[model samples]
Target: MPKLLVTAFDDEFCDEVVKVLGSKGIHIHGGNRVVSIDGNSQVDSVSLENGSKIQADMVLVSIGAKPASDLARQPGLRIVENGSIWVDEYMRTNAEDVFAVGDCAVKRDFFTRKAAPVWLASTATAEARNAGTNIYGIRVLHQIQGTISAFSTQIGGVAFASTGMTCRACQKEGFRYVTATAVAPDRHPGMLPGASELKVKLVFADRSGIILGGQVSGGFSAGELINMIALAIQKKVTVRELDMLQIATHPLLTSAPTVHPVINAAHQALAKLRAVGRELPPVKKAA
Candidate 1:
């Protein structure tokens, strides 16, 4: 394959993708946009706004879908400027007793409390469950206030996963944040067969130590590892708590006990927190 362009809202994740793809001899063009096509009858090459061109035999454009709010509009339901059906924390629509979920419903970010354009089946199902449980009357199942935007994907034998807010999102949303990264072998011993390198990055609120987001890239286990980080974010786990986290590690299943990437990343953030004299107590050494 020729050089390709991959765009993402998370700058760190985008760079990680570039690094992984680059190692496989795949060239990547970051932060560029296709301005025009070179061929008249077909796309022989594509020109980017940066004055670089990519030769290609095929061009695939994956544009996002907008919510079909026209029908909902006829019933006097409210719509956001982006045309998605507006809904409350419980997925309730503007009209009396009306509920909306899934891709068509507008979403907000969990920490930033800003409108989120993310769309995913998992998120939709979560919203559906919240709405379904609360339709008749409010219950103990808490109403969902915003979307965490947890997601994962794999490329070139590496699984990439992320959740909550990226550094870009934090900056754009005007949150003070700090970030740290750690690298480790995915197996107990690096010499083990199928052992792959794992990299974990975490972002936290600068003052409070609350986890803002996390990114992981590594072996197939990365798909599930990031989910655990996502759950921590949902439960409001801080960097201090993550540094003290306990987990089962096996020679065939996980990283070495001394160098787990997630805990080490939290340790990195904890060091920074201590430097600033934050109130977070240092986490006890992991066993």
Candidate 2:
């Protein structure tokens, strides 16, 4: 068993490695952003940000990547601090027709109207498809949608997932978001042998009543649960929709849909919004 030392701490990619590494029953010692290894024989101690050090048998350094923008930047195209090729709404860069995509471009989010990193395969493909179709003739999709920043991982037989912004992120971004958190036993009755504990937190914009993001911790339910939250977020679903959702649940398979953790969390957030006197607007439903 090679004692793997992980040093990748970038909020973006670190989670990917964490999810994969968790499968091997390997030990991880580092905090969210820091890892220290002292017994591995293959790789030596690796230095990183904040003067932190880790001794590892093997070191996997995952300094987040810079967008491959040298090609565009060489010709006087602008580059973001993170090295992404800057582009306009139509995916047009400073240099016309030289469209950049994948890990090489800056993508603006529709909801926040801010430029965030585009690491999602779906985002890249969507951008590429729009660019390809509009390159020659017709005008089409011109913007990327709200970046929910969804990710998930399986650790020690239990899965974890998150979407939208974390509590820290939302506060830092200054979003007027309300949150509802609920922890319950998965598979209904608490005493069932396979029943597992699940925690769900749903955050929504106070003024718009749109689901801002969600986080889930639990067993098999976590994987799909987060997806549901992500969709609600993507479609700007409101607490009302969640309250009115017709879901399928069972004693052995899931909790009653009427009081599911996800839906319950939305209800929870609504209370917070009302407590703060923020008006809850009607949330748009998906067609």
Candidate 3:
């Protein structure tokens, strides 16, 4: 088949497709995004805007991002470097009398232990609950994990999610990352999605080989995949811990926790880590 190539910033689906297509001898150019092969193509790139050209079969724009922050304009809020509002653990904004949540407020990075964006709805809700509760002498018993935070998302159908950082994310932060991926069926029968596939990619820090981020896609819903991964990130789950997950699965429901897709993906990430000669401790039991 003269297969068409695709690109997506949140592409856990494309990877599985490419694997299937590769085995079938289908012809497709796979990458972050498909660049136009012919010169007679419209172009767009930060570098391209500065005068650059890319020749390829087609161009697939996969920019993974969203609304940054608008805290800087807040009359009373302290604007941080990235235009995010500085908030205390209770998510209190500079006004002290006020609190910010979601995209508006800034939280600390779990990895670098620095102030950063906690823009996910998951984080937002948690911060909001805390901010609201804490506003009137309410003390949240759970001290939000500082420095490291996690998030999850599903794409193109199959469930995919990640916690912590991605290889690309780590590189931007000047941190060395180790990664692994697990490819398997979401069902025990394996033929349920005879036409469907599941792919998981997990990235971790090379220094500590700690689970940083993950992406999964396949079957029906991938949101849960990311959720579990987020927990892994919040608890700083190591590949070893993930390897020992006790996931509940109903062939039509999920992968066995003993061999959960997410956990397996961690194992895969572990292999990649070892290949680089980085010393990673045994997988920690899932908390």
Best-matching candidate per lDDT: 1
lDDT of 3 at 221: 45
Q: Write the per-residue lDDT of candidate 3 for residues 126-244, one digit (tens) a residue.
A: 77778777888867765576534454443333343445665656777898776666767767667775434666777877778667777666655456666677677877777766766
lDDT per residue as tens, model 1, 1-287: 12222212266557667787889998766557779878977779999988988999898787577888899999899999579899878888999999999999999888766778878998999988998888997773545758888888898877888887778768777889888999999998888999999888899999889898988887888889888988989888889898888889999989987899999999999899888888864544448
* 2 or 3, greater by TM-score: 2
lDDT of 3 at 278: 75
* RMSD vs true structure, all candidates: 3.7, 5.8, 7.2
Whole-model lDDT for model 2 versus the true structure? 0.68
Give me the runs in candidate 3 sitting further than 4 Å from their true place.
1-75, 113-118, 146-160, 193-195, 256-259, 272-287
Model 1 deviation from the true structure expressed as Cα RMSD, one decimal place: 3.7
Q: How many Å off is the CA of 162 in candidate 1? A: 0.8
Ranking by lDDT: 1, 2, 3
Ranking by TM-score: 1, 2, 3
Task: Give the range where candidate 2 is weakest over 10 consecutive residues by summed lDDT.
Answer: 1-10
